[model samples]
Target: MLTIPSLHAALAMAVAVAMFTAFASNRFRVEIISLMTIGAIALLLYLFPLPGTNPKDGLALAFGGFGHTALITICALMVMGRGLVVTGALEPAARALGSIWRINNSLGLLVTLLLAMFASMVVNDTPVLVLLIPIMVSLAHGGAMPASKTLIPLNAAILIGGMATTIGTSTNLLVVSIAADLGMAELPIFHFTPIVLMAAVICLPYIWLVMPRLLPDNSPEAGHEPRKFIATMRVGTESSWLEQRIDEFREKLPEGFSFLREPQTLQPGQRLAAFATADDLREAGRKLGAVTAPRWLIKRLSQDSAKAGEDLVEAEMAISADSRLVGRTLQTAGIEGVAVLGVAQAPSRGFAAPREMSAEARLAEGDILLTMGRESSLQEFAQDQALLMLDGARPLPRRRKALIAVAIMGAAVLLASLGIMPIAITSLAGAVAMFVTGCVHFDKVGRALSAKVIVLVAASIAIGRLIGDSGAATWMGASLALGMQYLIPPVVLALIMLFVTLLTNFASNATAAAVGTPIAFALAEQLGLQVEPLVLAVLFGCNLCYATPIAYQTNMLIMAEGDYKFNDYMKTGIPLVVLMIVSLSVILSITYGL
Candidate 1:
């Protein structure tokens, strides 16, 4: 018969509900809510210590999440993703994918979704998403889709892929391992792939077409009108532009970019002036084998600036009306500690390009100047020269280390995929290599991490621990068993999946898997039914973590980037969870003849 939960169990449930409400209300920052939950849990357990647990044990339970394997793994993966980005290791692949999206956004989205699913089946979902998230953001910035609309759907697709195989997700392995210990047959790698694939087929339409529509556009406006900077490309002997028709690259040219003079044939040492954003100019310069400015000047600045304990930064500055550098050419402007790459003469009646606007482009009032130098030096230069500094800051990509970063990433993935070592070790080793090899600067590691995500993850882990340690999870399972005893097999199976889905969405999937596996086995024994279908229900539910950010690590990883609110998860994910529960329940009933 159904019975009342113990006092500790009731308190644990109450705390979990309050935490959920706080997360959903969005009144406070995620970090604030998470830290508050941790403090409350610690204090409650200390005062009302559960059975054998002491205050010391209570403190450990509260603080243990900071050192969790899952947290470490997530942080390490983020650092490696940073290394790939700063080194420009994924630029080629991103550009290729972007070209396809430019051709047809719908087709590109479909291909990207399929690719994520397939890739995660072989490798872990976290690493796969880490690699894809930046690429997707780049595509979104390029106008394929808003990041808010794409990241959550993309993350969901990866989760579906991870559900397909035994090696797909850590929780999948945990479920399989726990089932084996409970006297169930150990499933093979592909044993459950077909079943999950079937479920995915039913859910794919919603993820691709419906989810993005439901999500609000959260992409930053800055991406659309990124600061336009003037830059001159000094064509070198190795430049592909040498003796080539300028019209051949017309389609590839960045928006608002044009030659100062329509040259029939490009020549070595020719200076090509263009108005483009920093990212566009850097990409064009790389393609043309050209330097944005003098190589010797950039190298000298790098050395001198480092000696002064400051790294060089690329910035856009505007020439004010009161500036002394009104009509002086770039060569004669004589701005020290900064290199003038290009100048976009301020538009008057029509457009006024000084007589010789190539290498000798002159600065006019209201003209934007693209310069590179130490942050402090840039500030000083702006102040002394009476220029207004722009808001955005973009670092130059480390192209020299691009190949090295790619090799390190490949090696790490290979070592882990081959079972040579655990993914945590491989990922951590890759992160260290990124720092040691200068692919990612040590100081920039902070940029890769989100303080909000770290604390939320720690809090989620602590909540999961409380649920397990206070016997709340066991109480929940027994209550579910008693309440659902009268239902038919198919309805009972659906209820079990639904229950586990709720657990996975609120608690960690790991907790759900740990708690639900044994319950499924015992309940099957009591009902005189096959254990396979019930075990499958638990496994499917563990991966149906769509309703909350804290439900899965990837969900949290995308939260800050997508600018998602708690309601976004509930709105987009709950439908998918329900669909899966219904579809999987019917599938299991037929497959096992329960």
Candidate 2:
């Protein structure tokens, strides 16, 4: 017999379905839809309050996400990530990974996937992704694969790894603890590891090869060739390349970098003519212990920046037709505060350099100058010289604070991974430390957070709470249980996994685990089937939070970086969901002898 749901339960289900539809359609701005969702939930609950709850309580429930610990943890994680970036703490890691990528794109992605997957087995998923996201983005900026092509695959690998162990995610621990409390045998940490590992064998190929193809290239400068610049690199006295033959140093240079003319043997303070993109030039300089501008200029700029309490920034300035710099060489351009590191001529003229051009490169109207200094100085220099400043002014890393930022991040991850304190507290403390230690500035904190993510998280929290509180989840579980008695054991297990997957994708992993675990136990009791497989089904399903951004924090974390739409998740994730459900269903059936 079918029973009609009460008004609150019915309304909650309707709201959830409608919200999912709106997100899928991609018709409205995510923020608008999210805010409207929150508004609808608050108004509906206020008009038709849940049993034993007043209107004020309803408002609190709807609005509580702004203060929710999960949101706080995410915000703090962003701030800490900003700290790492501003301090250049992750550059070495990025360079190492970029080397692998430079060798072979496929091999680099495979290594990245494996690293993320296995690391999350012991560490939590969020921090693992946090540590890797910036590295991947940096690689993308360095002319490797686009971040859009890599981040989703990386996120999937981490989620799968997180599914492998009981300690992989909080939701996994919740499932285990709930099952243990329900009188089931306590699952050891690695109890389900082999199963997820086996499933991963079936899934990794899809993640590495096909997923990247499905993702669009979201690089801001997609389809445009990076502008290459001719720069003179001066070897520092302490450089390892000092006293090496020019040919030997040439052989050691990175790809895309080349000398304009063969020079004499390398010597301290010797300048070599070279041409490469701005990023490649920076990389070459870092690797070879060389400076594009004079060491004294850099030192002076550093001192000026310190005195002004500002960070050094690199910016591009175009020589306008009417500019005073036209026909003047870089040495005589006489720009103050900013040092011109390189000159990029109009591409149609080709890269043919005259003899001694790097040292005496004449400024042309269409030339773009790569300069470094304080942001204020760059702006003022551009204005005074009638030069057009490019939009992006990238801050040079403050290497002095790099170690401090690294230590703070390590401590936060350590405490959270060791279960000493909740991630919320540790991450918050780390964010505060970043501010106090000058790793990230107080005024720059807003740059770290995304309004899209904020509103979406708030709305998702409200939806999750409403679904759990209004009996919608319970009603669905009961309906599943009623239908399961007629099905065979494998079908029942698959259905349970699918059910929890839907709940987790739409509501939350916590809510799904809370509602699904007892349902699994009851189903097992009624059907006289083994309880562990069913419980594992619920556990596995909770981690299959791939089909929506609201399904997991890491999902939203990658959204802005990847420039993903709601449809992007649905397109790539829905197939993976089916694959896992089928593979896990069979694996569980065989493993437990169902």
Candidate 3:
């Protein structure tokens, strides 16, 4: 019999479809669509409240996600992650990993994938990715492989590991809790570990070897030529490298700089010339204990800037033909407000420099000078010196606080993983500790939170609640039960897995967990089948969120970093989804004797 849905169920279905359509079209911004969805839910539910619930309750359901613990946890975790980056807490770890990658790219990738997968089984997948992303990016820059090629595969492996434990991801716990509420026994932490482990074993080879080849290279260096500049470094008397040999500093030298020949010994006030990008020159100069302009010039400018409460800035500046600085060396140039870090020699425009450009090389027309100063003074210095600025100033890392930041983050993760406190509280406390200990500046907190992700999570939570509260998911399950009446038990289990996988990949995994568990329970009862197999199918499918970014929080986290498109997930994820569905169906059916 064809049955009609109730008004609330119909409304929920319509809104969910519309919301998903907006996401799939990729025409509207995710944040905007999420805001619109929240507005629609608030407005619609106010007008036509659920039969047994008050209007205020409907409003609560619509607006509650903003205050939801999961969303707060994500935000807090992001802040903790930001603290790690700003403090350079992960640099040492990144360098160690980069060494392995440098040894052999394939071996390094295999180790990274396995480590990420195994860690996620014990810890939450998000934190594992958070800690590893910078390391992977470092490995990519060190010529191992592009992050775009590795991150998606790494994320999929982490998801597989999360599926193995009952508490690996919040979604897993949600599924277990909902199943228990529906009269099923509470599952142990590793209740389904064997099955998920089998799936992992089957999929590990694809994740490690095949997935990266399917991805495009999207690192910052890809598809663009690097802007090169010539810069000179003047060794200062008080610097650590004042009398050090050039060869001693070779390993510590930043990218994009090379010497004419390795000097036997450094001399005080020695002029070292090199060609590199502005950013590279700054990094190299900082590490080399070398000043961009004359030591006296930088000292005087730094004193004045500190007195005026302004930060010192570094950037590349180009010399114009009519400039008064055209023929002057760093010692002779009467420039103020900026100090030179490095300079690009004339007639060379790329990374491959034929000869070393020396510090004593007089400024020439079109020579790019890596200058450092306060922003206002840098602009003034540019106009007064007849130089064009190349790029914005890079933020200096708070390297001194790296240990403190690492400690805070470690404490939070330890507390959460041990079940001493919920992730929300621990992560939030960690974020606050970052601010309190000056690990991260309050002004930079905005960098940590992605508005697109926040609003989307909120909207997805609302959609999940609506689908469940309105009985739409159950109605759909009943329909599936009627259609599968004649199918054998194993085939029926596969169909259930397929359905939940669709929900999980198209909607939030939390939403799928919330909606699918009850439906699986009801459908199993309706068909007089073993409910455990059907419920396990839902659990496995909910974690199979490979087909879309919106399906999982970790997916969204990797989007901008990996530079992935909607179609990228579809291309790579669909096969994984199919594999998991088929594999898990057989595992569940046989294990439960369905």
TM-score per candidate, chains pooled: 0.79, 0.80, 0.76
> What are the per-residue Cα lDDT tens digits for candidate 2 across 1-594?
547777898998898778766765657777888899889999998998899999989999899867776667667776777777778776676677767887888999999999889868755677678778977886777677899999999999999999997767767766776677568986766778999999999989999999999989888854566678899998887777777777776756767787787676767777778889887899888867888998999999999987777889999999898999988998887777899999887543567554344646677788899999999999999999999988779899899999998899789877866668766688799989999998888877887776866777677667767876887766665677688778877788788899889977875675567557776776776678888999999999999999998788799899998999988898899999988998899899989998
Cα displacement (Å) at residue 419, model 1: 2.5
* lDDT tens digits by residue: candidate 1, 335-398: 7778877665566534643444454756678888878887888888899999998875457667
lDDT of 3 by residue, 411-530 (tens): 987786667776567878999999888787776688878787678767767876787788887788788889998998878878887877887787556656666777887788779988
Worst 10 residues of 3 by lDDT: 221-230
lDDT of 2: 0.82
What residue pairs clash in candidate 2, if any at all?
none
The candidate, 1 or 3, that scores higher on TM-score is 1
Question: All predictions: root-mean-square deviation over Cα?
Answer: 5.1, 5.3, 5.7
Best by lDDT: 2
